[model samples]
Target: MSKPAADHYESLASIPAGSSAHRDLSATELPSDGDIPRPVDLGDVHCFVQRHHLAHHTVVFEKAAIIVLGETPLSSVPGITATELRALQQETENKWKQPKTLYFTILVCSIGAVEQGWAQTAMNGANLGIPKAFGIDSNSKHDAFLLGLINSGIFLSVCLLGAWLSGPINHRLGRRGAVFVGSLICLVSNTGSSLSLNWPQLLAFRFILGAGLGINASTVSVYAAEVTPPLIRGGIAVSWQLWTAFGIFLGFVANTAVYNYGDEAWRLQLAGPVLPTIPLLLTVYFCPESPQWFVKNGQRYNLAFQSLCRVRNSELQAAKEIYSTYLLRRAQSKLDSREVSWSKKIAELFTIPRNRRAITASYVVMLSQQLCGINIIAYYSSTIFADSGFSAFGALLASCVFGFVNFLGAFPAVLTMDTFGRRSLLLLTLPMMAVTMLGAGFSFNIPADRPAHFGFVAALIYLFCALYSPGMGPVPFTYSAEVFPLSHREIGMSFAVATASFWATVLSLTFPRILTVLQPQGAFALYAALNIVALVLVFLFVPETRLKTLDELDHVFSIPTRTFIKYQLTEYLSWFTRRYILWQKNADLHPLTVGEEYQALVETDYEEEDMP
Candidate 1:
């Protein structure tokens, strides 16, 4: 052992620039307290970075012994030199290069998201045939309202119903089981809708279909978050939106192919989402349950660790994750036991100040998602295009264009959301969407007799789809899933989805009536104004959750709502401005390393530990 009595401790020997390529860095080893020796040599550091799974080390090649675990050294060893940082950086690089298994799990869970996307477009794609079959006069105002209700109202209302039930279902079933039950329900509901003999029958079945989708949406978003490793969590979580867009695009294309068959073809279109549900129900049994959920529910402790091992890519990483995520999922000791019942949990959402902000922010984000008037374009694009003088074939084709643009649009958010932070992306995209929506509304006043005018209007609507997709489309569902503590995650998201359902029902029920009373231009202008208000709310209230992990959020949300918002926004703007030249070039935001995130989160916690 190196002399501990010496004042200075410096790195002793060479750490080859490139360590052995075969060193399995995926699973780091963390020794117990008993394993550490006494009378530590300050200069004899031998481990890789002298790192611990949960502690931060900053071994300076100087007169101080390195602090590994507690404030004291573990068997005084020569400290790791700065050169060893090269290996440390390399190991970080490997962590993010996720294995095929992680990708496979994400891809499979995203199948449930496809149902979410399909729920919107299925009727949008098929609604073109609704008027003829139901004998509703397409040109009349009342019929237009009825048409909107048929397309969006029923589905959203029952979807809300399903969202309400998701809490208990998922609590009982686990993530995989919840997904299984929800997908099977959707399959059955879609088939029933296809066989509907009349408009009322179709609407009733559509409601059931919405309930199924509600269950899927509520559970799947949480499942996506729970299953992912923290460093890469945000990106994987946002893919829920990506897959939803894919489903919408797929629905539109299928509708175009079958629309030529006239009214009867709608049956097949309604039934088509059933095909994707097949893989979801079949594939879920292979997927692992959520470790965080297991910890929260207080069951299957061994299985939770095993699942965490698979998710984190190694046993040691899984142990660290349990320290970070699993502990935070529960309440701190004071409130821990208060997690007594669902009724108490529900009451706690509003009773605790931080919890209140979390759920309120979640509720409002989802409410805005629906009220922003994107659905007007999504669900009634066929009607809007036809009003703009497109033929029936042309209208259906235009809807397909909207779907494709929406699908492509989500890629930008999928890429940037975790990097620039959620709030930053919202600031950039919401204003752009607001502008495009107003432009779309004004197009109705132009000379529709001219092809240029119609083209211009169609282009704006498509642009709205593109802009909305990247920010508004995916952010709300993901954001809502992210904010709540583990215990309330399911119920909170269900409440948020239910709020979305209420607004969806309201908008779908009212949009057509507004179109008749105010015309398309006025209706859209109103929604644009609402978009501006939502943007302000987000800027002034919602905290930036860019690289912050689920555990750190407990403290983050505890900051006075307005104060945290102001600080985060200031931080964001300062960073952007400092890099203004680079910002102009529009480079993508880079992802955080697992070590970086863990260190950042624990820094404050550690400081508190040092306080007298």
Candidate 2:
């Protein structure tokens, strides 16, 4: 293709020229410790002033080394020499040209299947089973409380134990193996729930089920974050929300399908998550482990590179492109020899500032999720319908509808998360939630003579589920996971989510009392108030994690000026388009070089002495 016009070139350039711009060079630049930095050397350079003020500057360096021409008030150039310029040019090129892949879709499916299935929606099905076993005709407030406790009990344990296992599991088994193990446990525990005969038996099974669910929930987030290309890290991180929507939808379908089967239907509904686990296991089995995790564990550099290329379906050279980035990052982060024991790592989350902020943010987000009245609706939808003048069967149908709306809403999270961003969506959705909750609660407060009015309450509740599916239901987990550090990711997230489960228990057990003592209006008003609080917390604390890479995020956090959302969005878009454009722009840049030219170049780059 022909070169673009001068205006097009100006628009495409990232660095600005003239006194309007400041030279934002690194305060202290580091040299490359490993691998050849990928800039075309522009050779030697000399500067001379030809005439009056209209002098021109020429830079002879690497062909592809990025150049910026900025105007200064000084009549002559600075004392900086050609050698300094070459070193700076090579470093910048290496910094800019790292390769990336889009394997998050693979991760999205794997983690989505397990996380959405067992942790979130599968429990929604169990809400029906609780009342069925307890012999509650109307599902009184007491029963609602018990059901929440049953679900939340395991969550409490998850908070306690999840951190303990996260580090070891990720360190020893690797990302893929640890995640698969978690999924397997979930598969078995969900199946066990289907066979339980009584409330006590079901409760026991749920505790075991929660343990597996906890592991799956925490580990998948860590694995997904570790494996993603930095450019689309935020978008990939949000996939957890998308899959959760899927699980909620599936729960509804399964619950409705067995509605005609009566009490035994709860058993089938409990087992619904098992269907997705098989594929989740199979896909994760085939996918490569996280390259970063492998490098952290002391694997060879080329092996990690090849693994990335295998999943990316790109050329072998792409391995160097990716590997070179890790080397630079590892050096800069001072991660070369930084190894702490698992126990110490766990403690560090609380003691360290970065980890503290992230973990606290996670806890707040998760606690906010619990306070949203999700469990009250999840477990008591049928009971609420019955109280609102529907038959027991009609209540079950209404519950099914809630699930349908929840499921359908998840797809949009996948689409919108990367577009509108996490913080923007969180800020926008909370007010809508307030309106929906008020509508549902106020419907119950209206006079009894209003015919079909209770149905409006039910419809408003359904709208709440729709609103939740896209924002509250899915976004928090992804956000929590994103904020956590790699050192303690699994445990930190587990602790946060476990808190959600704990509150769910509190809400479940108390909702019956709350509804009865203060009436339905008081109960929903409490949740609406909590939603308002969550909105404020999100505005102040939650960052937009839509586009950032894991490495870039580390750097962003290292500094203190900009919030996470600002840097996250900027860093992502910068490289997201550049990597692909590199290949498109240079069709002639390939691995199939003619004979000795390629062999000698490869041999000179990698000798037997440097094999390790």
Pick out the ten consecutive residues of candidate 2 with the lowest summed lDDT: 18-27
Tens digits of lDDT, candidate 1, 83-125 = 3433233336754665566677788888888877876677876
* lDDT (Cα atoms) of all candidates against the true structure: 0.69, 0.59
How do the residues 1-612 of candidate 2 rate in per-residue lDDT, one tens digit apiece?
A: 001111122232333321112111111112222323333222311111121111222221111112222222112224444544443444335432332333543544554444555345555555655566766436466565566566565565555554346556877888777667777776787788788776677677667766666666666766766555454455566666666655665676666677788667777878887878777777776766777776667644445655665544233223323434443443334322455675676687766545665665676677777777776787667767766777766666777788777778776886687788776777778879888998888888666557657678888998988888778877778777766655566666766767776676567657777777777778888889988988767755565566655543443333322333344345533443454555444333122112333223222322222210
Worst 10 residues of 1 by lDDT: 5-14
Give the RMSD in angstroms, all C-alphas superposed, for model 2.
16.3
Listed in order, each prediction's TM-score against the native is: 0.77, 0.69
Off by over 4 Å in 2: 1-115, 118-129, 135-145, 162-164, 329-336, 447-451, 485-491, 543-612
Note the clash tally of each candidate.
11, 15
Top model by lDDT, which number? 1
